[model samples]
Target: MNAIPPAVQPPVNDEIDLAALFHSLWEQKLLIALVTLLVGLLAAAYAFLATPEYQVQSMLRPAAIKDLDALNRTGVYELTPEQAMQRVGASLESYDSRLAYFRANPGLFEALRQPNRSLEQTFESFNREAFKMLQPDPKKIDSLSAYVGIQLTYPADVNGVTLVNGLVEHAIQAEREKIAADLQTVIQNRLNQLELKMAAARANYEASKDARIAELLEADSLKRAQLQDELKALRQQLKDRRDNRITQLDEAIRIAKALGIGKPTTPSALGEGERVAQGSVIRTEVNNQQIPLYFMGSEALEAERNALLQRRSDDFTEPRIAEIAKELQLLAHNRQVEVLNQRENEDLFLKDLAIWREEATRLRNLSVDVTELKLVSVDQVAVDPLRPVKPKKALILALGVVLGGMLGLFIALLRNGLRRGASRHHSDQSSLSS
Candidate 1:
């Protein structure tokens, strides 16, 4: 056999074919080097140019009026604390309802960026693009948000900082309006409920008032009748007393008649007994004018006679009827006053009912407003502005060094690839020398 070439042995499992790998790599090495350098330089440039972002944080507490004391007890109110808390929470939840109102107004954001945006609109194009450029995604805004969150967020750009700040401010405004409206609505609802209760109460009072008035009217009639009856009895008693006084006067008149004071005293000149008659007549006249009238052995008869004559008066017009008339006048006046007072009270009750009705109406309006205000609730506060965080200059510098070394290695790899044929010849020489 011709001097056979020594058997060419395949490499073992533990060994790698470096020559084959190096050959394959050598083919693409130039393009790979260029791409690697480009990537490294691009990374460095990104570090230098990346904009930085600053954050503004805020926390808010939900506020609302609550019946805290009563709500704390379950057995007393037949409701759980959770339920009562929920009610209070509902009142506060309305703050989120007015978010849209703030979103439309950009001026609010401008103010927020005040120190930053002195005079620049900060963009080459429309405000929308500028805002986007200055701000980050909204979803990432909040760092710590649950009950309260960031209401607005903004990005920093040499040109568009104002726009981003404006957006954030609008967001906050929207939230605030929403909160106020919500509370107002809840209050309104409560007011309406109170009004309804008050209205019902007023209606009942009015009904009761009517019944009371009727009762009073009947009582007034009874009182008037009683007064009239009393007057009648007094008048009768007065008449009887007057009748007794008149009867005594009649008796005195009879006594005076018997005495014959007004008859002529001269005797007739016809007979012997005529002088005796004249004498008798003179005696009668004496008795009537100045006789000592004794009455039934009573020692005070003379005093009584004097008193009877002295007590008579010409002004004694029917005393019974006069007294009755005076009493009736007083009763009629009292009845009139009671009637006036009752009417005034009824009027006042009606006025109170009207006021309650008005209050109820206002309450209703407020409840509706509360619904609209719910959008601004604390949970809805903006957590993030639309801006990117600032780049770390130190980190970028470190990365630049690393990438530069990798780039130099890639350049060396390409050079090795291009000289692969020369190296292979040199390898043969090494074999001969060996």
Candidate 2:
């Protein structure tokens, strides 16, 4: 097919030659060593010159039930150990609390000061990184109890142990004060409420007493009026009886004078024979008629009328009149109303007085010293660390050497590749020129 171009063949160099690559790398060993040495020295300088940081940690656990018993006993508030621990954790995590502690105790963080930064800036930096709250991982199955920790990473020169411990104590003290204040507020509010109730109760009692006084006065007025009316009726009845008696006496006296009889005489006082005769006659004439009042004789009737007319009062004439007079005299005063008005301790008569006084006393006497309260338990206090935690010199040195060797190797390979490409290009150009 035009001599078929004899099946032109392509270059076959798919496999890399290990020996040639080794030789090329060996040729550039001095440059590789120089690069590696420079990187290693830099790593060493950084490792040695960097300041060391120390870590101090404190562990907190829930307080015992007995430790929180005092606060729980005050029925106004209740606090559990876990809640206390949570409060302490929140305080520990507060930036303001940390800043306050730092400002109040400047000497504690003096070593962290720097010439290029203000005290506030330095504290900000320290607050950002130095403090850490450590908690157990929720995913871990081995975590049985709730625990909280405060870890402080500070420079070697700073007293991390004192700083961490002081921070923990300060948080606890702050929580205590807060709890105390809350308790005081609760007790005060209760006292105020009790006072209001007591005042209301007293007012109601006074109102009731006044109402009772009014009721008694009204009843007394009614009773006195009734008694006075009854007394007046009794006196009129007595006068009417006396006046009628006088009229009957005058009629009897006129009958006695007309018949010429002066003294009281019974038919029986006459001779027996004459009395029998008169009785038979009267029996035949009078069936059931009573003897005439004139038979009582005018003298006796006149004497009775005179006695009734001369009487000063009708109180003795009827027993009920005397009783009515006594009752009227008693009603005039209303002893019950007088007693109620004169009562000095009206509250003592109130139904809930004892209960109100007892509650008020209990609230007023409710005093708790938060300083004595054990809000949390420090399972582990921060201790002075024996060694620094930062600037892991050994690991840094090892990494530096490894990275340096790898970078050096990469540079060597790049240079060798460039050289080989340049040589191949030159050969191809020479061939084209020939």
Candidate 3:
């Protein structure tokens, strides 16, 4: 096999060729110097001629106007710092809001726009500048704390400090008004509902009282009628018993006299010996002692004893009926107590409703009071600053020097590459001719 020709390779150095690089740069020093000088001059001119911007900074804390109670019930509390920042950031970011802001203060962006500009041109020019000046710092926003920071840059003619304060005021007022209006509507509706409920409760209580009174009256009338009938029967039976007893005593005395067993003149003598033996009204013991006890006629005595036994038997059902009636009345009494308790519960509910109404009214009033509230308090106010915040001359010039040096180095390397290619071409041609 024929030996393969060696591959042509560019020279490689493990160590950097410092001397050759310096020589090459020296040879093309004029071009490098000219290019570096041009870039530096341009940077210097920009640093001096550009309009300086001044920044107005202010720190704000959004005060909590309402307490925890408001948060739980109506959620009509004051704006927080996070919310304030969001509103401000949104307003600045939005095209329409920014446009409106620019319109309100016509002179704010007048310097940026040329004369006789179209509406679109004016808006575009305004937005270009507004975005640069009004943008919140990414570093600051990322590490947000309890306080919101506002920084706006403007030209010397515009008052950036006044613009920041005004923006904050407007945002706070708008948010407060929105929340307050919503809370008021909710409060009114709740109050109306509470009033209706209270009215119903009162009417129910009255109806319940009237019905209970009617029920008690009817029960009392029924009980009174039953007791009156019982009393009348007892009185009539007692009178008949008294009259029959008297008639029985007279008949016994007449019978004794007619039978001649007890003579009117000799009753005492007959009663002692013969009265008991004959079963008369007066009786005598075995010792001839007369007793005052009297006996009815046999038929009457038997009939009356039978009637008494019947009366005792009748008393059994009357007592049991009365007992049952008493129990029924007790049940009615218990029901009346339950009704009273129910009315009491309704009264409690009404009282609670009244309290709820009062609370709603209080919240509504608070909401009204805070309708146009200034929730943000300026902890640090901005003033018209005398010094310019931008166009840092020292930093710009330093960066220009570094960039210019780097460009000069690139140009030197390019010149060195061209010189190396010419030398290599000459050597190749000489070798071919030999």
Candidate 4:
């Protein structure tokens, strides 16, 4: 009998067996398509059936003003730009503050608790998502000048835009009040400091006035004493000069008599005798009326005494000295006037300082009851948004198509490998039996 040749195993395909693989896949194309279609349909249905959520968005720009300008506008606080922004940020971040705000305006949060009848459930839902609607953007938190973005996600049924707007306004008002309160505290502290300074200034002004008065009094007394001493010295000097002149006149008259100068009946001789007799009187007439006599020592003595009398005549008399005393009194009066002027000037300065202090105190104590304090400007307020933001149908459908196609291809490849393995096993068994 002819030896049956051992069943020869097929050679391993060096490259992919494209023809056979294509034929196998084509035979199972119905199964693959059915599986892919079922998966795609299921995914599409799920996507369309899911509830859609809408986004309520807004942006708040913190509009800052100068501190003095803010004070001018509000008449209550010296609020800085940075502090204003910080106050808004604090309101946005504070959960308790927001809760309190919502509680105050029940209308704001009441409508948001729809579909849930239980109070606890409503609160849980509000705390979970609704309360977070007015939070500041994390990216722009560090940069105070940048606009703060606000986003709220809610079901399509809710009026998210109107709700967000209300919340934004509420938050802004809360922050403004907070800022005003803080500034009031600051002003109070500053007022306290000003009160102390004003007290010290008043004390200093009082002391200065007292010191000036004392100085003026002392100066007036000293000046009066000096004037008295000057008057006494001038009077004594005039008296001594008067006595010396009289003694010289007496000697001249005796010399004339000793020289046998008899009184002549001429006008020139009579004038000389009269001049000799005039020196003995308290007051002398114009000496120009007298004539000179040339006899023994009488002529020389009369000339010397006349020269002494003329020199001494220019000396201050009682009336002239009294005029000088009046002038000194006038000078003292002028000094006192100057001191009074200085005091007046000091008083004026104190008056102006007091006025300034009073004005500052008025500003410090000024009450500001702001019904509205606008810290932030809404760059873009949320409008009634119609379109839903979540549950993207197109994306879901595309993903479903790709995943279903991959799964169908995997099943097709698996079936082909199983068929090949079974065929190889059956052929080997037939070869063994033969």
The TM-score leader among the candidates is 2
Candidate 1 local Cα displacement, residue 85, angstroms: 17
lDDT per model vs. reference: 0.47, 0.84, 0.62, 0.68
Candidate 2 vs 4: which has more TM-score? 2
Q: Per-residue alpha-carbon lDDT of model 4 for 1-434, expressed as tens digits?
A: 99967777666554658899999999989878888888889889988888788887877775656323645564545555545555665666566765665566666556566673664556456666754434446766675555565677877666677777776777778766666777777677767777777777878877876787677777777777777777777877777877776685666568576755544233444446545554555543454555434242455556666766666443455676877678677756656546555664453567457675776767666766543555666778888777777788888888888888888888999999999889878977886676
Instruction: For candidate 2, list the clashing residue pairs, or say none.
Output: none
Q: What is the lDDT ranking, best to worst?
A: 2, 4, 3, 1
Model 1 weakest 10-residue run by lDDT: 68-77
Q: What is the lDDT of residue 318 in candidate 3?
A: 48
Question: Residue 314 CA error for candidate 4 (Å)?
Answer: 41
lDDT of 2 by residue, 362-423 (tens): 88887777898898889999998887888888888888888888899999999988887888
Listed per model in order, the count of residue pairs whose N, CA or C atoms clash below 3 Å is 42, 0, 0, 0
Residue-wise lDDT of candidate 3 within 296-396, one digit each (tens)?
33344445545654553243434644665565566445566465656645566344666765766675565345554445566677788877877877778
Candidate 2 matches the true fold with a TM-score of 0.78
